[model samples]
Target: MAWDPAVYSAFAQPRLRPALDLMARIEPADAARVVDLGCGTGNVTRLLKERWAAADVVGVDSSPEMLATARGDGGGVRYLQADAAAWAENGGAVDILFSNAALHWLGDHRTLFPRLLGRVRPGGVLAVQMPHNHYAASHAVMAEAAAAGPWSEVLSPLAARFPVGEPSFYYDLLAGGSSHLDIWETEYLHVLEGDNPVVAWTRGTALRPLMDAVDGAWATGFLAEYARRIQAAYPPRPDGRTLFPFRRLFMVARKG
Candidate 1:
């Protein structure tokens, strides 16, 4: 199934607040050619253009459907459907390589970081942000519950590929590099409203692969169990909002 921009936008938009905040830290004067890797629906790319109006901004993603929805007249931002990892490897140099909440999908940051760092021009910046919630009960319980079910034969193998790691892991990769690097982690307490906010959040990002892997019955069952586990782990407050503490890793590195 193609990615429905409408459904995704409603949930993903709020989660992207931290990424936009990180973008604000970049020097506008230093932004001439900006590239947004894994630019889902081009939302962040548009913001980058707004922040640096003089810059030529481009958005790149592996999903054509997401890239198609990214089309807009506003930012003069060009959207391209391409593999970010390959683009970085081919030396698609830019003044700033910005990625928001998308790096975790590519996996193997140790290698991906070096490739991305190489694409940045000397003195240019490479900024990235990704969610670090694989170990959280929301994700962990999904695998545990699935492995105990009849679908365990198939789901168990897929669960092993969950892409999540510690912030310190990325910090170590950028450390001692030829460039200056700043790496940190932040937990955003997003007060989301809705009876199934956790489900809404996963549908936009983390649940895609799972949805693609199973039929409707299995998927529905999986989501139901996952939601129950998530709600128990992250109870909703009296005000009808959940304190969804999303932990994210950020790195801003400038090549020397």
Candidate 2:
């Protein structure tokens, strides 16, 4: 699926908070090579370069559009276009392998996490953060709208799987591979402005694949129905701002 940098970056401030929070927990020092796996648009990747100024920072992403934006920023970071899972498997060992708001898109975490931890050099770190709000109304309503429309035949398959597992699932997967592991979850209640902000928010991420699968009147009707459902699920507050509770999972593991 193609990515729209403008749409994804529309809520840049809110989307960045979890990455910043994840960065604060990393304890690596004087890292040599740092790879930002699935570093969309390279916003957080630039920060990685700034944090580890001496390290060679490479931003890996599959989207040409996102990579174009990242490359345009020109912060002395190398950008590579590759499938994130392929990169995770074959990308050379690094001092720090960091991913924010990525990885959850791929399945089979049972193998993925351990394999990722192995890619970190001895005493190096693997840090990641991903949206853990699959059960929340924001996503639940998306599934609801998909199954209730003529677009269901096309969109149902896209919404079939939510790849993010619970905190314990990850803890068990990473505990044996790392000398030190820190795993946690945080739910941020984002105060968003404007009409149907939730739909706007998902349009950039979760809603993109479904939207991409169809077009014409079918697309218009599907979006309209989704918007109607989302508006009711996440009504605006008395102050005209919407409180969007987004939960994210974070982990920082230092390989033994």
Root-mean-square deviation of every model: 2.0, 0.8
lDDT of each: 0.77, 0.93
Candidate 2: C-alpha lDDT = 0.93
- Model 2 ranges with Cα > 4 A deviation: none
The ten-residue window of minimal lDDT in model 1 covers: 170-179
Best by the TM-score measure: 2
Tens-digit lDDT string for candidate 2 (120-190)? 99999999999999899988888888899889999888877688998899999999988999999999999
lDDT of 1 by residue, 1-256 (tens): 4566777888665667888778876765567789999888887888888887888898988887787888854468988888877887884679898998878878687898878888888888889888877766657766775676666776767666657567677767766564677778887777889885876787776666666678777877777777787778778899888877677778898777
Model 1, residue 41: distance off in Å is 1.2
TM-score of candidate 1 versus the correct structure, residues matched by position: 0.91
Clashes of 2: 0
